[model samples]
Target: MKKILMGVLCLSTLLCGCTKNKDIQIDDKKVGQVKLKFDHIVGAKKLVLNDGTYSNNSNETFNINILKYFVSNIKFTKTNGEVFTIPKEESFFLINASQSESLQPTLNIPEGEYQTLEFNLGVDSLTNTLPVEKRAGVLDVATNGMYWDWNSGYIHFKIEGTSAASPNASKSYKYHIGFFGGYETRTVNNNRVIKIDLTKAGISKVQENLSSDIHLMVDIGKVFDGPNSMSIATTPMVMHSGPHSDIADNYATMFTHDHTHNFQKIANNEK
Candidate 1:
């Protein structure tokens, strides 16, 4: 029957149970839009994983219950250097602090002026050695907790709370930070580089169309600064050697920014 009616029109173009393939036609340019942002914080305020705790300092309480992860390959770099990745079979991203609207998540890109941007907070090694099918938001896996139930993959970074310096041994200092190979872990790549120099990002115009708000800030004590140390009732684990993953790559280099987070931007609304 026409190959089962062309396999139901190619599975209805992937969205009705999504095998993905809704709209993809890059290297052709003309669909410009990028309002990508995901800002959540703790130190200077704004971060609420309520119910399972994690309120922002009215007196301080913490309990992330169980957060999700993943921020796959996404690159954009122009200004003659020329680069625009974003195809790890469609760059994944699943951040869930129990979905506080998932903190300003946005995406769309076409126009170009980029200087540099790179991503991969997790899920590398070709989609963690690929078998694929855990889908929803952020590559699904039944709603993106970035896997790793016992000894799998995925779990780049996930901070929890309720400390007095956690040490009944390990009830949840669960810093499941990953990358169990060289060239990409340990003294290799705790990675960092959001150095998006949009003319030093004071922003004047880079072929603008509209929505361009970029405010990224995340300095939760620099992800436990060094040796991933920030305790409570106790949960300490930093298993990335080479001087503790180069002090977690110097605490993600204390994320450089201009304003704050918890509102997220890059929603270039275009003209």
Candidate 2:
């Protein structure tokens, strides 16, 4: 009887060991969510900048008529050489000021450390041709003025500022920047990416579930050197900001290195 009991106990122990090993094996191919947030550091909604710096001084503040842009193709890179891209179906994001209060927004990320991030500064050809009824977020027909009488496509960015530099206005420089059409020179197209390898390495140990909020600084001054290369004299009208789009492309210059950002952590209640 003792031998029989010992044999039964050993069999139970082996089964439990196998079950425990199976439980410890986590699926490494799980998919994670990628979030995006934006911040428009415009000095004031109604106010404007003289030398691209927001100020309370009357001489510095200029009235703005419109300011909008599109962000698309949000992507991520893992430290181990893996890449994740926004699904082709829902990749574009519109970063409009009228829709949101500020420019500094947070992005949602999965539960792993990312090696790099890539995003577009303006709308792409695929999104531009999308009909108003099909648009979402900043691309909504109600907000974005990209509609060219239902014939043309959406404008990538509509930034209008009024100032002395603006169309002979009393204001300093009222500027309006937007895409013209689906197949016109007025349309704007620009994309940018950054390597956050160092930053990713520093925070690799952090679980994505722990960090939910991330900060990305958007500096308009860096986008276009107001008083510098992009002077009011040269880029006064949409036609000017377009043909000279290369000059306007400096917005990337404003995109600097990464910094400490915030996000949600794994919930204590979560198993």
Candidate 3:
């Protein structure tokens, strides 16, 4: 009877250890929410629709009448190099200068200490190929007027404004960029993968079930004054494949990490 009693106690101890390990595993996999805010500016001034003054590296003066773009495939890389990719269907976002609310986007990700944030400046090729009917979530909304064509693909980025460099009466300019083909064939994949270092902000850990907000700034000047700068006087409108690629490449250099804020919570409880 003494030996049997000892055997039962050992088994109970082993069961408790297993339960504790299982709980720890579940907690490690807990997911958290991260909110991203896109702030637009031209030089040191806030970007406003219809009228925002700014000068680029080319010495060309322009006032933006429309400024909108798409960001997709947002992911975070932990200090150890583990990547937490946001679900593709829910990852695409359109930021419009005219609409203040579209600038803030909330994303759910596995809780971890992220060292870097990565995202695509334009829609991915696969998602771009999907027909409008087959697309779901944010992609299904045609009324947003972001699409270019079903066979070609959606316009990943767009900007319309007036530049002093243009000789036209209205000084109007329009630039739209996207892939030029369907399926595996594409003339130009303007999609850019942008990585931002977050160590400065000390976003070491995103607590489980809590919400963290990351503020990013998009300098409009970089669109025209980037590595391969363009002038409205020479090429005021770029709606097709050629010059659009150069501008898209420039647009890729417009984002920077500003800061971060967090709202801590305990699992399912808010604090």
Candidate 4:
């Protein structure tokens, strides 16, 4: 009878602990939302997917058919240097050029005055190590074809198009970049930072006037001629290629500051 009584007491203690944990989760503070818009363009004109012809710094002409990439580890830093990092598990995003909705979507953020926005241009190392079955959200390889099965890693960025320099009949060229271990990793840093002024958007405190949108531009011409220039005739494609650090690094820096708009000021939504 004593053993039965002890077992009942232990079970009650366990249930109590679980209830406390549940309450902690439910007590999380409410936050506001921010939007980020991406625009793809050439020197001074908007880019037309698969049809617009643009010349690179290297004087090579090309047209992009598909452009998809991943952005993760988004963090916002205030002028005072206080940083707010998005929850790692829920921060991964896959962006496709064909999808307008993907250009700018509202994302939840803690109430704060953010002056600088930063994010990774490719999948982070942690998500790169996980298998498809074990991943979730945008990192789920099953839903997104960003996974490379043969080499074992996510394709952080992909650019498929046709270049006049291509020797093939289709004049097709492709660049796929990622982390594949060993010397192939190429030691390239794919993180990008952008200066932002959220005051104009009326984002001053947690949940105060939270509707803010920032627009950014991605220049395709920069891809072939950033710090270095790429020739499609020499390197038209990279699927399983172990070393694509040059092209990856070039395209990673293509993002530039555009304009921000659609500022809707709502009262502090904090709970």
In what order do the candidates fall by lDDT, top score first?
3, 4, 1, 2
TM-score of 4: 0.76
Candidate 1 TM-score versus the reference: 0.29
Ranking of all predicted structures according to TM-score, beginning with the best and ending with the worst:
3, 4, 2, 1
Tens-place lDDT per residue, model 2, 117-163, is 67766666767666657777656766556544544555554555655
TM-score of each: 0.29, 0.63, 0.82, 0.76
Candidate lDDT (C-alpha), each:
0.51, 0.50, 0.77, 0.70
- Model 2, backbone clash pairs (residues 3+ apart or across chains), number: 29
After superposing candidate 2 on the true structure, give the runs of residues whose Cα lies further than 4 Å from its correct spot: 1-37, 42-65, 98-110, 131-133, 170-209, 226-228, 239-244, 262-271
Clashes of 4: 1
What lDDT tens digits, residue by residue, belong to model 1 across residues 1-271? Answer: 9999999988786656754222322343554445445666655665555444443322334555554556667776765676768656667766676675654444455554555556656556555555656443465454445555454555566655454345634444555566634334432444333444444543311222334344556555455543444444332555443244544464455444453222123333423
Weakest 10 consecutive residues of candidate 3 by summed lDDT? 19-28
lDDT of 4 by residue, 117-195 (tens): 7887777666676665768877777666787777667888888899888988889998887764423455454334334
Clashes of each: 30, 29, 0, 1
**Superposition error at 34 for model 1 (Å):** 1.0
Cα miss at 90, model 2 (Å)? Answer: 2.9
The lDDT of model 2 is: 0.50
